[model samples]
Target: MNYIALSYWHLAIASILILANGMISLWFRLGLEKTLAINVVRMLVQLSLIGFVLKFIFVQTSPLWTIALAVIMVLVAGREVAARLTTRLAGWWSYGIGTTTMFFISISTTLLAVAFVISPEPWFAPRYVLPLLGMVLGNTLSGISLGLETLITTLKRERTAIEARIALGHRRFEAIEQPVRQSLKTGMMPIINAMAASGIVSLPGMMTGQIMAGADPVEATKYQILIMFLIGGATATGTLLAVIASAFRLTDERARLRLDRLENAGSKNV
Candidate 1:
């Protein structure tokens, strides 16, 4: 394979764009200027390190290295989910919610995709495994984060109504079903909207990158459709798992709401 070298001019242009991202972030008052810079820098460093590591691993074709990378990816994803739900859930509850959501959706889709779709030589090829896991994990992370926020907000807002329903002999889950459904729908709107407007409004990152990498446009489109469908499945599954797992955490014996229990939910415990 031929190697491509980055010229000084291209490096300079890329640096300029990176700087522009920071400047424009502050200019727009995104309210996350510091966060924006921190995340961008982190992404740059992490991705740069991963690039080299992947190159080595792929060349060596080490199954051990591939397994290690997959474990790291899962750990990273689980941590992200735990961090996202920390504010609204307690110790084991937070871990349970995050882990269940990620494991169920990611493992299920990945197994099916790899077994039947990609069909790698060993069904555990690092190139295919890592990329697919990253895609599913990244999107599921976002979905879980949004779903947690929506569910928590709704629960807080409807605490009185929910308590009344529970007091009226309704089960904890039954009392919260409407809000749960509504919150899930709201949380899922972005993915739904993206799917609705995919081709007309946006090319999506994966498909665009594939096309730019010289893949046929039609092939790219097919890949994009498959990915989007898979993302939708993962998101729905993750959201449902997170929400349902969290629901149990917010209820006590006799199926009553337990708002007081969540008073201690925060990063310290997570």
Candidate 2:
């Protein structure tokens, strides 16, 4: 079966939903109408641009282009992770941690999947690699952001308690262990919930798209399951690395808590 093409008229008609949402926000004086409108516009523009770029990359099917695009995705995701943090490590530490963790986990997982699970002809096929990497990088980005933000916020709020533990002869790692664990848990919660609720509660986006594009339901289900597993693994690995790295950056060699390293130490403005 051929995929149904959506024309400009169809897109315009579909955009009514967003307009209605913005109108509702405006009527309620929620102050979100502008944000909603802007986000809608941004989403359209960004997705359209990416769609074109991806089309080109798919046509070219060059390994260099694929690798460059993957690197760009990781860099952007890392910046997003850094931006989401309420309190960030000084200088490039936050970006470095996020980028390094995301790069390692996303690349490793993507390679494993492509090489063993879903080996295409060229092995570096843009179609498979790009989409898979995008999913992994996107999930890992969110997980790392959530974990890092939680760790920073918790450390700021629980400084007294952490210091008390430290004064009681506990190591820095010991003092911050609870917060680190909590942060990791918080980061993983979204993926866990999605995994638990998949299929029964809702059809995931990928599966829905695949089914719409005329893929077999059983095949789509299998692909969705693989993607979910990859996402989960990437999220956990990235979150753990990011949270632990940030935790270490929060302290000194003397096991002293250094909240000073954070730019906005006790603020939840993020």
Candidate 3:
């Protein structure tokens, strides 16, 4: 395949948003002055490296490498979930919840589709499996993050009310019902809406990529619809479970509030 180098104008046009985001972060007092710079640098470096790594992986065409890359993404995503929600929770439990839920959802969806629907050659093909898993995990990661944030903030803000509810004869789940459900719903709404408005409001990335690669639009849309439905299922499951898990971090063995726990749980393990 012939490659075309981007001209200076093209490069500037591409980077406009990066420059704008950094400027806005500074101007609006986002308190991410350093973070903005770091993120920009990380994005540039990581994407550049990922481009080469992906090329190598595709050429190597080893199932091991493909699976390893998928595992790495899951681990990284797991770390983010743990760091964002409850840092002191210890090893592999976060990995358990994050990666397990992700794999469960992705595999289940893919198998159901492959068995009953599109039976592609080598159903576990790296190209198909990796991207499908990425889509599920990517959305689920955001959902998990939102769920954790909601749970933490809710517990913090309603500490007194939650304590009172506990005293008034309510189980932990019953007491935290409203907040937990709200968080789950809030976390999953974006994915739900994306599904609802997919064809009308936007050309989804997967479909667009497939069409750009010269696949039939009809075939591309079929894959896009399948992935979205599967992702929705994954998001709902992951978000609900993550919120429930986060709630445990805020309560103790006696099922009582542990407000002080939040302080130690905010550290990023990275």
| Every model's TM-score | 0.88, 0.93, 0.85
Residue 170 of model 3 has an lDDT of 88
lDDT of 3 by residue, 1-270 (tens): 233556868976988778778788789989876877887888779878877887888777787898788778777777666666643334445555665666666556656766677665666566666677778778888888787677777877787888899999788777787778878888998998887788989999999878877788899998898888888888888887777776776676787877665544645343
Could you tell me which 10 consecutive residues in candidate 1 have the lowest summed lDDT?
261-270
> Which 10 residues in a row give candidate 3 its minimum summed lDDT?
86-95
User: What C-alpha lDDT values do all the predictions have?
Assistant: 0.78, 0.90, 0.74
Q: lDDT tens digits, residues 1-270, model 2?
A: 789999999999987877778788889889998778777888889899999999999999999999999989988888878877767888788888988999899999999999999999899999999999999998999999999989988988899999999999999799999899999999999999998899999899889999999999999999999999999999998999999998989998899999888785334322
Task: Score candidate 3 by lDDT.
Answer: 0.74
lDDT tens readout by residue for model 1, 1-270:
233567868876877777776778689876777877788789878988999999988877777988788777877787777666535675566666777678778878887888988799877788777788789888888888788777777788899999889889997689999878976786577788999899999888988877777788899898788788888889888888887777777777688776655633453655
Candidate that scores best on TM-score? 2
Task: Show where candidate 3 strays beyond 4 Å.
Answer: 1-9, 83-100, 106-118, 264-270
Residue 57 alpha-carbon offset, candidate 3, angstroms: 2.3
Candidate 2 local Cα displacement, residue 24, angstroms: 5.4
Model 1 ranges with Cα > 4 A deviation = 1-12, 15-31, 263-269
Candidate 3: residue pairs that collide: none
Q: What's the lDDT for residue 77 in model 2?
A: 85
